[model samples]
Target: MKLTRPLLILLAIVVLAGGYFYFADSSDDSGQSNLLVSVKEGPLLVTIHASGELQAKRSEKIKGPDGLRSVGLYRVTIEDLIPEGTVVKEGDYVASLDKTELDEKIKESQTEIDKIETQLDQIRIDTAIEMRGLRDQLINLKFSLEDKKLSMELSKYEPQAIQKQAQLDMEKSEREYAQLENKLILTREKSIAKVGEIDASYRQQEHKLNRLLGFQKKMTIMAPKDGMVIYIRNWNGKRGPGSQISGWDATVAELPDLSEMMTMAYINEVDISKVMPGQNARITVDAFPGKEFQGLVVTKANIGEQIRNYDTKVFEVIVILQEQDSLLRPAMTTGISITVDSIGTCLQIPLEAIQSDSLSFVFKKTRTGFIKQEVVTGPSTDIDISIALGLSKNDMVSLNAPSHADDLEFVYLDQDEKRQMIQELENALTRRIKAQQVIARSVKQENLQSKDTGGSTFIIF
Candidate 1:
């Protein structure tokens, strides 16, 4: 079994040749998998992606009064939306609470007031009649006194017998006249006192009735400012009842300034420390695509708290938009990207360029073929990753390449398909634009008609 030295050497040579061929073939397959991409110069932006909402910069969320007495039996119903962007004047009826019960109360109070007024008038008439009788009695008393005096004088000039009889007659007449005078004076004083008491009572009742009427007026809810009406629902999610209910703190409606707005965002504790006042942000709403609004971080919460689904503590952040849009409204969901840090004119690449396991690499197009070049990367955002080293501007790299494609046929067909998809998308966009224009025109015509009918109309763009 032991071979000669020359034979052993020959065998080793054959094995080595076979091993080389296998290695070369494997290397070729690996090389074919490499992707080709292109690099370009652009501004690099680093942002933190956070889902937020589009809210008024200074919204007033009105809550109904907390006590049971403040709520009436009648429930308020929303007859209309008040057209989101309509301008309102002061003291306008933003929304109405059902005032049937309150209105009835007012009528009842008014009736009582009227009845009291009539009783007061009757009291005055009675007093006037009593005064007239007193006046007549006083006149008779004065005449009796004068007649007695005259008789006494005549008796003094006549004989003694006639003097005694005249004196008795004068005394009797004097007593009768004094009694009449005292009775008349007492009756007049009593009548005067009764009139004063009745007047005070009537005034007190009038004040009480007036206060009740005023309280009833509170049921007719009126707008505090010139703004749009927004309905408020309870935490339980019920809006309003069909009929008036006695005990619910449901906020029927509110008026808010449509021009001004602010956004509220919750930052988790991990990222809260990086957030600060005056930070720049970009706001995007789900309802509006291809549109971004400029916003500034106006506030950062000093404390953290837990809410609904999030287990970690969250700090509130308020963002103010530079301009107000008609489409923006309270509670409209939005996505906010806070620019934590950004460097201008920095070299960057798509986030997909970086591979997993903290290793970053890009395919560099060289004279021979696309080669895998190792790269050093820094912080990465959702869209782009910062290139720290190993990549220069104007380098051509592959976006996505098939490593297993033996020929260019597959690549050509893929490119054609991509173009067709893009064309379809463009056609769809054109149709959407046309449809939107038709809707816009219809809205415009409706607004004009509303104006002619002396009502308000709102159009959101």
Candidate 2:
């Protein structure tokens, strides 16, 4: 078509202005629509959730003798240890300690005992020899006394002076014999006491050696019950760099009975009060998806432990598993949902559906539109809340406020206005459905027309 330059420029401007206005209006209408949700009626459970790991409720700790218990012996080393994760029976060997120290101590004690016994034998021999010599001296003194006595009797018939001298000699012999007899008795008693002392010391050394031998036999540790062996890690304290645990610091491992399992959950002080013993709980092991186990809170800590490298404090809570599973293992991570409270049936809604506190409100949908309705709420959880009043089943509510709500006045709606709005909404929806139908019809008609015309036409704005 032929056209002037000024007219062509005016036409381009008009087309560009029309296109801009159309696109701008479409963009405005394309802004986010209101998100709506429905108030529901169902079972609402208020739960306190925590994360923890599985542990044995009744487990035995494998530990070596520590200070004072070791009886002043040097650190004992593990000569042989059973591998971790081995299932063991009662009285089965778990590990063995080096017995070289005990053997050396026993030998030393035996040597000491031998030395004492040798001294005791020598004392016995010397005492016997000394006692024999003392007896011989006593016998000789008695014989001399008898001879003096006989001499005194014969001198009585000889002369008065000679008889007196013989009597003096007899008296001297009698005194010497008495003195020899007393010395013999004292020597025997001293020898007996000395022998008894040496024998007592020898027995004491033997007893000590026997005790050491017993301990040496005890060097091999045995399992007290049937359970799985779990090697302990960083017990009493952490291992030094590039060094193994000494017997003094060694905690060998644990024998946990897998039959009875419990969860060791740490709850922060904020939520700790809400958890209590005998509370019903549901546990989900991370290792097994979609499987849940039931449990009860069995224990709670009175004191809180400081979190590692953090300022927070957490109290340990034990949840006893009601059912045992073969797949459940100690130290496996688990998700615990403790049902602190539960109600059979109630009106509930998403947590986001309710607004405000003290006097709560929800935007409930009427047949017309949404209205700010006052609501009474009860216990709530992270996702669902129980509506005690001011709501009913099948009630729809807006999850968010309307875009134009700030511009509109929040006036109380009269009965007539509510009815009018409901009618308007219904009419609008009906019109939308009709419009869709008309478009479908138009497309069908166009197809027929194109078939009749055997061609098509394009209209551009």
Candidate 3:
């Protein structure tokens, strides 16, 4: 029994130690296996795809009333219009501006003119009454002066005291008469000046009223030239009924010369370097599936601008269609594929499989386990890297740093091969910079701000 007890205790200790080691090794290997991913080999075609809309290559603006801002209105609503796509000739009615605001303003101006007229009449009457009163007072003074003069003469035959009093009264009357004459002259001049001031105000108000009346007549817009009417577009949508036209953006509609059409596309700064003038493009209209149109890249902007709702800056790219189709129309959304460049059948792998500092390497699988295998990389996209050297299609790479990867030695290339690979990468980067500069100079000549490039989606293969 003693022998059996000791033997059983030792056996239990051995079994427990074995199980502990087994679980510890299993957990380590499981972690390493999870980080491993296989290398892939295939053709790498880098195609830049962008979304855009069709716009008229050239169009004549069908404008709202000229000088809306001059008439004290910054914006006015389109109250009525002939349906879009209607053919019309010069001098035919196209649209009518809403007269509600204009009518209110006209009413205010007319009221002001009438008020000035009334004020002018009141001044004239008041001046007449005042002048009549002044003249009567002057006449009374004149008669008093004559009587006082006669009295002084008659008193000369009476007493000396009576003559002196009569003389004093006559002088006082003469001074009063002279002062009254001077006052009449000044009053007449003042009345004329007051009337002139009021008359000037009245004339100004009359001119304003006249202008408003003339503008009212022009509120009914007429076509300036002969063509089919196409409603103008804004941030919201096509400017139709109820859309407000402003003095700054006074355009109401357009007469598009539909003989030609072009697409306005927005390409991100990352891919703009790949695009240039005369590059072939394939465009598909969203309104119709399976129908395709061929176009050429006519322009590519060098500078980037902000697009609504996108976080990245994008450059404008213009694509001109080669042929006109009956189904083609303005403002149609299109999908554009511009073949920028392609790398033929080559090896590629997920970008996450590679890591770098001063040197680039991968956690490559080996017969023993995993090792840090130094690799030479080619051009890369946002998500994948092309393999130039140090890995094969059959080889597997770790997506993340495997367990103890920091301690593993790298399977590096020879010094000569490594130096050559570094030279190649530096040259590629230099070439890319020069190409981008060329694209910038080519498309920087024109300002294509008239078209709105929004709601864009992008893809690169």
Candidate 4:
């Protein structure tokens, strides 16, 4: 049974050829299987999906009182806050601000006020005593004047020289009495004025102390309305230790009305125009899977804003929930699918069926194999796309490339194709946007130059 050397070499060549042909045929079969897909007529719903967080449309923000608005007391820090997500009633304690500083200020002011009041009382008493002493001196002066006059009259009966001396002495006493009376009146008026000044000072300090006490009372923040509490980011722009809530910047907790809720989503700038108010939407919370809610687009931002930590700009779209759920809470992640357009019947195929670079086309099955057919596409959903022309309900199309087809090739364009379409639209939009920006800048510059020129002319004139 042993074979010769030439026969052995021939046998090896035959085995290698057989293995090559078997693999080649197997690959061709696998490729053919990838090509076969059916094109059918069905309903196509064009939708735009966006992810965002839930929030209340109207929230009652509870912040610390704008503090004292005085030097070193313009802001207050939150010392205690009710647990987040706690349901609170109106007038319930929401937060308490640090009262140490304000309390100390009030104490100092009260002490100063009390000291001033005591000084005022003593001043009033001293003024009264001084007035009484002045009155007594005045009475004494009047009596002495009367006695001198009587003596002068008695001397008039005895001797002319003595009577003349008595009269002169009485005139001197009259002058002294008049001067004493005037002095007593002036002293009384001066004492009254002094007491009034001290009393005014006391009143001013008392009012200041009362104002400080009022600030102390304002340190405790109460819920203005019944709602659930949601803790807010602190002054340091975060919510952990070392972060403190402040009244100066209005950083505090939010009391959001749970009855009305909405999800705030950022739509890509390219898709912003497609989203409109009043469009219906279906929403699902990531935390509560299998639970769905309905909503409508209530608002779309007229201007686009850049998302933090991202370079692309996005428009904020508000979707109001039509039904309220007890499990739904603010800040929960939401998956929103908005129905922008829908059609009753249309010739559609899987999104994978379409192939394009500059032109759009799909591979149509033929009796021989498969052939390329140009297509006109309309609105598309996440999976299937609507063909407006060049397709029929019974037509069979390849979702991928066939083994024998040369023009058709399988291209992985699952999400990439959608992004490409958006990119192309964005490019067109960017060009138009740039043109508008240029014109706007030109107008602004012209206005500014005109103002400057007018000012110069006025100065020259």
Candidate 5:
């Protein structure tokens, strides 16, 4: 064994040749195996992906000041707000509104009130001076009447003509005095009416100003009870800093009860048909990665709507979480995988192995080469498709079209056999539909009961 140098050199060349041939042969077999994949037997899931947002099942609405319209304010902007999901006690400051517009209104109202007060004072002064002048005229008229009466008496002892003139003068003075007395009474009544009118205007302006002042205090909203703040959503967007609140819809935010929660998702119209109540789902919170929770579809929209910047229509779907967690927060984004259908242990294959034109078929491997196999297919995912019939666990199929596969022979099920397989598939689908119907009925009943029990459900988008 410890022999000559020539013998050792010959052994080295032989060993190198053997390794190169063995590796070459092994690689050829490995490539062949990679092309031919076996029919797998296991569970296959056909799922749909949708994004969701966490929401509370029940919540109390926090509103801006009531009777905003009564103060002539059409709208107000939220100037400041605490970050959403912040916990606080009752009567805590939650948000503040921009009072600049309201303050301007108050200033205008006060100015009007001042104008009314000035008018009132002017009326009082003018009335006092006019009444004094009228009274002085009445007193002078009375003195003239007395003098006319004495003149008439003196004339009585003179000529008849002079006596007649004195009687006329006395009569004239008496009539003048009576007319002045009536005019004085009317003037006093007019002055009282003017004062009342101006005073009424002053009171009205003062009342308006007072209401504006009171409303200004309420512009600072407070939490009605103890809970975390969740902003209310509207067409414009969620109620937050710089968002406008209309007089009619003054809701600012919400205090949600986190004991019960749900995830709201919008499903594309294409995938909506597969979604229904009672179907199970897996939900993952975007905020908390690597954690998943179980859920069930509780509600689906009857109609579809156009979303902003979306190319296709989407239907709203509501899924209720089965468990509660302390880290769950409202409005948190989540990833939802709704399991629309689940097949039990069955034969499955890669989708690439399957090809179709007028009929669905696969290129299955045979003793000599590959052949076209017409298969009855079932539910499928993006990567794999389930075989309802025509393939089994022992079969092998090509992942890609084999070279010169057209020259190969085809193995197809006869019409009767194909129809029978389709019939079986129909029956299974019918069973699943009936089962879903039963689940739907139960979900409906639960919804009705929840309504009777007064549970709230709302979504922003």
Candidate 6:
């Protein structure tokens, strides 16, 4: 048994056969799958998907100015979210503050006014009493002067000495009368001036107090124009506007006109250069579907703001809607796609179809498998990439291909081997069919005008 060459040869043959079968099966399982596609001539649109918000084209926020007095002691509670899309008219009561505190303020001011009035009345009375005393003194002095004059006349007939004494007495009486008259006149003028000063002071104080009181009375918030109410959310872990009296950081509410709407979006700095004013855009709101609103780029921010962990700077862009709807509200989140550039009837391919290292190529499906064909590519939009060379109209190509094929050793299949490749071919055929369907559907669905440049059928497996 140890020296049997026949037995050794038989074992050797069995091992060889087993090895061949094992290799064959393994190759079959690891073979590339087929991808099917039909190349059709059509227009491709490149779009940039940007998220933004639906907003009024012209909207103003009516905010309560800081330090506006409250109407009552009861504070305003701004908890309710106004019903969405409710139309309002001018002078409508959007929100109101309690008036109790304002009332108390008014009363206090009134009390102050009353106190000033009382002081003024007392001053006037004192001036009148002084004036009356001056008048009585003047009358007594006049009567004494008249008696002295009469005495002088009678003494003139008696003696020259008596006449002289009478004359001196009359002179003293006349001087007294004149002094009393001057004093009365001066007292009356002083009294009148005092009363005028008091009255002027009271009026000034009253005017100032009244103005303040009037402002307090207007503390009841009212809408300046017809619009819808939108409540702004508070940020930085703080309550929304009108939450506290911590000195005037309140957002109370906003009245936004429904007729005008605009979408505000932030675009990354890398792509901001592609955006400009007057570019057409399509907008979709999360609240609505199958409804696309038309808009135009109205503004592009010159500056950038950091966003996310990448700290990428983004520029703000505003898109104005052509038509406004009642459903449109301020700050509603929206998805906006700005058409930075659109080429009608341009040759394009799916972004996934192109593979690049130092050069780019697309996989052209064949009966056996896929063959790599080099392509000259052009600018890429969000979805499709422009193919400038090495591809013709209606040239069928694979959407996605394996990345490691460049490193694999090339293998050529004979007729028999190719016949055995039915499974792979069928899979490729199925994929090609689906790809064709997709292309056709896309053309019809997108209303794309397509023309066949070449006769090439794509098989996706």
Best by lDDT: 5
lDDT tens per residue, model 6, 1-461: 76698899999999998754533222222565434344445565556778876654445554553455432233444433345455668887665554455566677767777877998889888977888888878777788888999999889797888888999999999988888888888888888888788788788768756765775544556677887766543323222434542223334556666686777788888888766665678999888888889987766667797655436878877777887677767777899998765545657777778777665777765444456777656557766787655567766677666445664333233445444444554564466446534542442111211111112222111
Candidate 1 vs candidate 2, lDDT winner: 2
Q: Please tell me which model should have the higher TM-score, number 1 or number 4.
A: 4
The TM-score between candidate 3 and the true structure equals 0.69
The candidate with the higher TM-score, 2 or 6, is: 2
Which TM-score value belongs to model 2?
0.64
Instruction: Return the top candidate by TM-score.
Output: 5
Ranked by TM-score, top first? 5, 3, 4, 2, 6, 1
Provide the TM-score for each candidate, comma-separated.
Answer: 0.48, 0.64, 0.69, 0.65, 0.82, 0.60
Better of 2 and 5 by TM-score: 5
Sort the predicted structures by lDDT, highest score first. Answer: 5, 3, 4, 2, 6, 1
Candidate 2 yields a Cα-based lDDT of 0.70
Give residue 250's lDDT in candidate 2 (0 to 100).
Answer: 50
Identify the runs in model 4 with alpha carbons over 4 angstroms from their true place: 1-36, 57-73, 87-94, 118-187, 190-194, 214-228, 232-256, 394-461
In order, the Cα lDDT scores of the candidates are 0.60, 0.70, 0.79, 0.72, 0.83, 0.63
In candidate 5, what are the lDDT values of residues 51-134, reduced to their tens digit? 978988777778899899999888999999999889989999999999999999999999998889889989999989998998
Residue-by-residue lDDT tens digits, candidate 4, 14-131: 9888754533232233445644556788887778998988876556667666645652475566777777888989999877778777888878888888888888889878878887
Task: Work out how many backbone clashes candidate 3 has.
Answer: 0
lDDT of 2 by residue, 419-456 (tens): 56456546644664465344424421111101112134
Query: Model 6, which residues run further than 4 Å from truth?
Result: 1-42, 58-92, 98-101, 147-173, 205-217, 221-228, 232-260, 301-315, 323-326, 349-376, 390-461
Better of 3 and 4 by lDDT: 3
Candidate number with the higher TM-score (4 or 6): 4
Q: Write down the lDDT that model 5 would get.
A: 0.83
Model 1: residue 149 alpha-carbon error in angstroms: 44
Judging by TM-score, tell me the better candidate of 2 and 3: 3
Model 3 accuracy (lDDT, Cα)? 0.79
